[model samples]
Target: MTETLRARLARVGQSYAPHEHRPLAGYVAAMGAFGALAASLAAAAKVTGKPAPERPSLGDVALLSIATHKLSRLIAKDSVTSPLRAPFTRYTEPAGAAELNEEVRDHHSSLKHGIGELITCPFCLAVWVATGLTGGLVLAPRLTRLAATALTATAVSDFLQMAYDISKHAAEGD
Candidate 1:
């Protein structure tokens, strides 16, 4: 009798018990990919004769940080992105519970699980988004600033909308 691949993988996963290492391994892989991407971008910039800035401006950093934050949240939680995430994650609603709806990874494979984790976590995705936005700033400053401005404006609008909702509720209570 020969041990099947699935069986072998199951045994290995069982050996790792609680499976903490899986996520760490995924993170390591993601970091390596990000490093490679950054390197490639740097090489491309050099080839194009685009010199790297000595230091990014404070405004650029601020705009990018805010945009990254907004983009991450939108990707991780916005209903508009649910279609994109649906393949990797499942939505869960608790019965009679006041807790917010949640999305959890379907965990069919290590790669899928890792991608699901990255997509669902704003903090994890922020690093990648910020890197791309920063690279854009170097490669196409005007377009990057334009997109960042739109994202920043949307973020502000979201805050104002929430505040108005809260104030309306308070006024109703009063």
Candidate 2:
């Protein structure tokens, strides 16, 4: 049944984008997994008798936003975290100070290609990161805030360091 469904999806993908691999089935699978995770998290909260907050605070949202940005970049592009994405992406070059440029590796399996794309794209991964962070905010607010604070601080430090470098370069030019 699964094979039949996959074949049908492949045909649809081919019709939609004859020249490119669309991986519609793979995308569907990824979306299903995300939905499952969210459902399970909700179930867990219910089973544990932990009520989700009525509304998250503005400060918490801001912290998670910054943390999510930092974490998504770290996972998707950081040189140190490349190993996590190595299976799906081919190293191309150094993108920045501690980041890498990579191209998704093509494979016969659309699932692998789909996952590779997700793991290599920071913008794509941010949704997953933000979801997890939001879940954490409900389940463990204190720990979540602590971790978010650290990530936010690191992001600010990176920006400051870049600004300092630019200032030094300008001074040297003068």
Candidate 3:
């Protein structure tokens, strides 16, 4: 009797055990995807004869980094995306001082679990977002800067809102 493909895959999965290897596999997959994207973007740029900037200015990197960070957080935690994320994650009751309710991976499958991990983790998503924004900067500087500016402004607004809430709470306590 021959072992079926599914059986072979099951055996392979078992070798990785305890679920720890799933995330490593997922991350490796993500990096491969990122590399492929970067290569494609580079080819497109070359074909279009778009000149690469000699060097991205320090300020441009700073703005893009902040905007990417903010956008990743918004996508990962904001209620607006809860519907999209619902299928991928399990919701838990918010713990003390938790601004956004906890949503974790359901771990239904390695692929789904990997996607859930990427979607829920700001740090993981930031790499993708930053790459996209950086690509945009190269492809369309004006438009990219406009979008990044708006995101950065929103980040500042969020900080101000948090500060105001803290001050209001302190005032009430005093």
Best by TM-score: 2
Q: What is the lDDT of residue 122 in candidate 3?
A: 85
Which regions of candidate 2 deviate over 4 angstroms?
none
Which residue pairs clash within candidate 2?
Answer: none
Candidate 3 — which residues are off by over 4 angstroms? Answer: 1-25, 94-99
Please write out the lDDT profile of model 1 over residues 1-174, one tens digit for every residue: 134644555566667766553643444457778999898878878888888799989998899999999898888777667777778788775322121234557565666677778887889899888988888888888999999999999888888887898899999995
lDDT of 1: 0.76
Each model's C-alpha lDDT? 0.76, 0.90, 0.77
55-163 per-residue lDDT for model 3 (tens digits): 9999999999889988898777777676777777876654232335655565645556677878888898898899889888888889999999999998888889888
The better candidate by TM-score, 2 or 3, is: 2
Relative to the true structure, candidate 3 reaches a TM of 0.81
For residue 153, model 2's alpha carbon misses the true position, in angstroms, by 1.0
Q: Which has the greatest lDDT?
A: 2
Candidate 2 per-residue C-alpha lDDT over 19-98 given as tens digits, one digit per residue, 9 for 90 to 100: 99887887888899889888887888888788988888899989999999999999999999999999989999998779
Q: How close is candidate 1 to the true structure, as a TM-score?
A: 0.81
